[model samples]
Target: MSTPLWIFDTTLRDGTQGEGISLTAEDKVKIALKLDAMGVHYIEGGNPGSNSKDIEFFRRVRELNLNAKLTAFGSTRRKNSVCEHDVNLKHLIESGARAATLVGKSWDFHVHTALQTTLEENLAMINESLAYVKNSGMEALFDAEHFFDGFKANPEYALAALSKAKEAGAAWIVLCDTNGGTLPGEIGEIVSRVVREIDAPIGIHTHNDCELAVANTLAAVAAGARQIQGTINGYGERCGNANLCSIIPTLQLKMGYGCVSDEQLKSLTGVARYVSEIANVHMPVNQPYVGNAAFAHKGGIHVSAIMKDSKTYEHIEPHLVGNKQRVLVSELAGQSNILSKAQEMGLDVNPENMKSREVIDRIKELEHQGYQFEGADASLELLLRDAYGGTAQAFIVDSFKIMVERTGGAMVTEAIVKLSVAGEQVYTVAEGNGPVNALDNALRKALVQYYPGIRDIHLSDYKVRVLDEKDTTAAKVRVLIESTNFKDTWSTVGVSSNVIEASWEALIDSIRYALLGMDKDEYVPEFVGGTHGLSNH
Candidate 1:
């Protein structure tokens, strides 16, 4: 590895700018602690000048012990205003942050158009604001907004902006690709010129407007920028900022640069997930490095090759990022896909066993009829076990009925479910806001008395997809139910012409899977594929 790369995380400040991302002050603190534990060098918390919430966050964060340099973000002192009287800079000092990052206009066009101030005055703003922050005993950093575009339009003026920051005792002169339009080659060239023309330490910040934020950040680093600034999962305004999730691993493992310790690097996946969860944003399944499907293999040929030599289809050992290889079973699956999935689940299905072949055929047949097992591990596991007669007959679901009344007075929906648990017939009735919920309640009411564990399983998310929209109302519906036992989560799937029936099928598998736990030692030779007739289900 080469020289250490300073990681400046702006997730708290910039990440919240992305649409649908709203983090509370508590959420910011939680994310900050995660970043601190993950060994980031600096964290640009938030702009305390504009948002009152950020002021509260700064006050709360002061009580916590953290290792990362916590910096408050704000623009330079207002144009033509005294730096000492600037409200933005005043808030930065009062916020109790250890450092302050001041963003100043660099592009000549923005100086004349946006700020409506003379270019010289903008330079003064950059200089005085940073100087005041530094004189206040806080580390001062300069963000040259639109530096790439400024350098393209007026190279001298852009370099002049950075010179003012250097003269103000700025600790890091960060070049910002604010518009995010600069390509990799141009970013490298401009950053290289800035590095040579200025005698200050260089940093890089970029957006994803053109989907090159990560690329531009890497370009700047390649051209002698020592610090990289970005956000977790690339959450920011417009297309978002450069993603630290991808940049960290690329720098540490692939580019021969030391960003985080190997142990800290392992926590990168967890950090990304935790931040996404708190931000209430869903990570794209194909997101690089940290997504659930990043290392998943679905093709039969790929699974076959990987089973023999994992390097054949994998880039790196997934465990390095705290993830694991996943084999997805579908119509595209081969015998190898079945065997690989079985191995992943710790099932002892032999590669040469005909039962394994039977399971593959069954999955393909079901998938042909519009069943998707990639997201329904519980249902697929049940199928695999049933083929080997390893699945125990826990309960038998019999007659079920739903009644919805919308005549005039008050709308009402009810469900009646009849099932047998250990030879004891159970009939239960329940009311709900909808048909599916009523059926879920009725079914759970019937089984909870016999199997108390059923009470622990609760549905987290429910999704239904139409297999053939051309069929319209007659189309087959695929229902996916995500359930949790408060300890572990699992997904199950069912498909039928009736949406309610599909939901019931998924609900049944969810309950059965939870009851069976998927850790059975018995693997009987006799098959019981259709043993659970689930009469009238």
Candidate 2:
């Protein structure tokens, strides 16, 4: 039988210590509920005494009645301070948490230099503080800060700290690699020794300074640690804490240790995304287990094999983690890449026919011309449809113009747009902070009356890349625009010698893609002009 293992999530506590991460009282409560639904064993919430905001979060979570034990975090009673009257301890008890985890100095160097206290006094603090919490009816967990480093330096003193915590009725002895500098081998050896000597259950906590937090945690588990302390998506101070996203799947699927149910495991991707969304952090596309590119196959050979047997290039089924395999078409693509990508986009193209052959040729030619379709799916869709002569000619852009001037020592920009829609000409003019803004405003103002969906479309991001530097100021540029209709976001790219023209191409594609998903009743006009701009061929 598999040994019983517990997952303790500390995302709300340590995760917030990450440089760009911050959560409100309501945010932490929401994350706690999500963890409970995901079947984690415990959630190490923030310290209510240090941050007043945490007090409100604990109060709010009480009404939630979460299944996972809510644990409060704090430092062991201040040096030479009484446990009963410790303000931090009082806040922890009043927070109404089910568990208390107090971190104490386990390294003799920290006891002398950092805390300015003797090793014996530090042991007394850990014992008394944990004893106070246990007596207050809260399960006490002692976090031995710097235990691995301390054990390496002075093995006897570190063992004495764990013994003190065990004697004080600590339900779990958590060995923490506080500095995040310990390697996996050291973690495994130290945890294995600690597990043999400590009477209480053992837990492992690590940081990612060396990018080995996950590896170190797994090593500890192999060494007989029953509890694993980590954060979702690896959010924490410095390089971050151990990533529960990678650890959970490895433990349950590969290591034969069950942490969550099979069904709950499928929600791993969703949970990582949800916390990322709430934290307003940009989820790395290459993050293991739950990233966009985790299972994506870009190489033609890889994609072809994945089509026959996904096991060829993938370690596990993508659906197991709620992510789907993506086939990307690029200059390095083959017939299989084109056909797979086209079919995925709902285009009526097949591998048996010569249609994918033509698409592949055109894609390579375009890539040679500084047009990349890998990251711009919206533009790629339009290009593919154009090849089949199925692209909808929604409207025609006859011409546009921009003017910039300085009046009263302030720069002003204006744009004029002329369009042909349904055999009728529509003209509009607008002013903006810049030429791109003016053009965007003018174009949208002209089309919003015909396509109400245009009103819903908003440009979220716009980036421009210089394709050549030898020409200096007269270099070809590529523009990538990310637009969203509040429901879905898509990206389009355009390349040209002029930045304005490149921006126009991407801006038009953004509008065209937005209208494609809108009401079909939108006016599709018969226009008199070229079907697309110079860059569209």
Candidate 3:
């Protein structure tokens, strides 16, 4: 029999402590649903006493029929105040959460200096808070803030604090690496001792200041901690909290712990990406398990070996976590890379085909000219389809023009695009805040009528990199545009000396890819224009 390790996610609470991470009530609800669907044991909704947003989140979350228990976070009562009289404690109880977590100072230094209170008084605060929550018929968790440091400084005081919480009915005694400076060896040793002393279940919450949050968490689990507290994508204050993305797979696949169901584990990658998308954060390509580059093979030698035996390179199957193996095309790629990539894209092509060699040579030549296809798989697919003569031209740009002018102390930009779709000429003009926006507006206005599916496509991200910084304005710039139809996302790239030209090239490729994947029967013209009118030119 395997010991069950509970996954306690604090993404909604501790995660928002990360710099630039803010979540609306709706966003929090959406993430909670995703976490519940992924079989997380507990979801710390938010600190109910912090702000109106979090208070509202607790209220809104009650309406959700989630499988995971919702936990409300708060601090222990003030120095001399009774737990019943504390407003923070009142809010936590009124939040209607299934569980309540109260963080109290455990370190003797913090008790004496930070709180300016006696160690005995701090112990009373932890005990009284947990006792009150437990008496109210709710599960009480005591978070001993800075436990590792506290234990090292005064093991007597730290163990006394845990003893107090347990005696006062804390269901779980959580040790927090608040400063995030503890190593795995120290965590394992300390956790082993704490488990021997504390009678209740143990939990671990760690920060990533030393980049050892995951390591320390696993150490605690190895030493008998039953619960792991962390956030999705490691979003939290300072260096962030432990990443459940890495922790979940490690616990289930590597350690043989039944942290989540097999089906829930498979949704890990999609859920990670979903949370990042809702947080408006760029998903790191190299993130472990669920990242774009996690199982991506780029080198020729690596691709050759992986094609023959994936076990030679891959640690685990990508599909286990809802991620697919990617074969990237680049200057470093060989003929085998091309064939493998083609096969992954569902293209039937022989390795000996001359067209495969031509495509490989063309990719290398284009890369030499500053076009990198590694991050632009959509563009590479379009190139291959065109070379194979299997893709039909979506539209042809007859001409386009952009105008920038200053009017009444304000800069105004407009674009005129003339294009032919299915032998029909359509000319459109639109104004925007910038040249790229103007071009995007004009192009979408023209194509939305012919292909209503294009209306669903929108630019999610745009990035520009200069090939030669020394050349300044004359340098060739590479523009990468990420477009999405709310269901799928793809990246396309373009390079040119002129910034506008490069942006336009990437934008055209984006539109072409969006239109190429649409079913003709799904085209329904729905006008979505108002403030700035779309005009026929």
Candidate 4:
């Protein structure tokens, strides 16, 4: 049996505080429901009194029977006002949540500089706020804002503030490294002292300014903190908060803590990607657990050894986190890697036909052109599928033209596509926010007439990168688009000097891949005798 640590997610609250993510109330609820399904124990919805969207989130959460407890967050009542009389208190009550969280000044400097209040007055406000929420029949949690700095600056006052929250009935007292400048050793010592002093369970909230948010969080956890508060993808003000996506896996697989079931942990990467999609944020490729590069092995020696025995290269099995090990074929990939990836994808290597060299040449050429197959295994699978004649094309793009213009320097891109499906010609025009979107929409619209199932598949992601950022004026760009049907998600890539041309190519391939899935009958036999079967090798 493994010890369970509570996961307190604040993606809806702190994550939205990032530069450009402001979801509507409906989007918030949708994300909340997804988070609940992912099995987080608690959700810090938002500060209800702060804005209409947050207030609406509380109202909507009240109407939901969410698996995770909804926690309404706000600050302690202002000085000179009783918690019961504070309008913020009334707003907290109106949230209709079963739990409440209140942040209070823990640093003496903040009490004097920010609040313009005496230390004694700040203590009173903290105690009064926690007591009022407890008396109102709600579970209360205290966020000791700037706690580390406060503890270091004035240990007695910080300890006193935490003691007040405990006396006032806060279930958990969270120590916040608000400025994100605290060292891990300092956090471990402080958390150890506070845990020893306070009877209540301790929680930790850390920011990433110094790039130690995850490190500090782990240190605090080791020091008796039972709850971890963070946002997915490390999103927040400034650099961001500790990323729960990274934290959860480290806790479960590496640290021997069980924050979630193995089944849920296996789908962790999928959940991380899913949330990023809803938030409309680009998934960071280098993110620890769920990132594309997490389990990707690029070297020939590493790939060969991993294929023989995964433990040779992998710290933990990739499947444990719903991610699979990938052999990245590039200029660096040797015959061993080409063989390994080909075998994994159920490709027929045919050494006699010298397919390895041909495949390696193609991969190198594609790499030179800025096509990264590492993040798009589905696209690679499709490539392998086509190379072996596993799946025949249902349609092919004959020609396409796209026009893009900006009104007042704002961009508007449109696509005109022509294709032949089953020897029948079709043409369509569509407009979109960008060239890729427009091309994708037009292609899908044209294909739907012959294949109505295309409607079931939708584009889930579109990523474009300038190949040479330093030479932007003369740079080429690459585009990768991920699409999903009811069952699986596949990524396809395109590259060209022109962004529009790259997007168009990727869009056409994306629709073609989706259509390929519909033609499973065509590839079932070819794969049966392929590398996935031992006899083929």
The per-prediction CA RMSD against the true structure, in angstroms, equals: 3.9, 4.2, 4.6, 4.8
- Candidate 3: give its CA RMSD in angstroms: 4.6
* lDDT scores in order: 0.85, 0.85, 0.87, 0.82
lDDT (tens digit, per residue) of candidate 3 on 412-452 = 99999988877799999999999999999999999888778
**Residue-level lDDT tens digits of model 1 in 371-469:** 888888778776766555444555666788999998678789999987776778889999999998998899888877766767777787789999999
Candidate 2 per-residue lDDT over residues 367-423, each given as its tens digit: 887887777777776666666554556678888999999999999999999998766
Where does candidate 2 stray beyond 4 Å?
1-4, 385-462, 481-491, 500-504, 507-537
Q: Model 4: residues >4 Å from true position, as ranges?
A: 351-353, 366-379, 403-414, 433-436, 450-453, 456-491, 496-500, 517-537
**TM-scores for the candidates:** 0.87, 0.84, 0.93, 0.89
Q: Is candidate 1 or candidate 4 better by TM-score?
A: 4
* Whole-structure CA lDDT of model 1: 0.85
State the lDDT of candidate 4 residue by residue for 1-537, as single tens digits.
787899999999989999877788998898788778778899989988889999888887788899898998888998988877788887887888778889999999999999999999999999989999989998999999999999999999999999999999999999999999999999999999998888998999999999999999999999999999999889899999999988999998899898978887887788777777777777766677787777788898998888789999888888888877777766788888877777876667775676677767777777877888777666566555555554544566677888989889889888998877777888999998877678778888887888798888888777788989987767888888887663456677777788776766666566666665676555432221111111221
Pairs that collide in candidate 4 are none
On TM-score, the candidate that comes out on top is: 3
lDDT top scorer: 3
Question: Which has the higher TM-score value, candidate number 2 or candidate number 3?
Answer: 3
Where in model 1 is the C-alpha error above 4 Å? 389-461, 482-490, 507-537
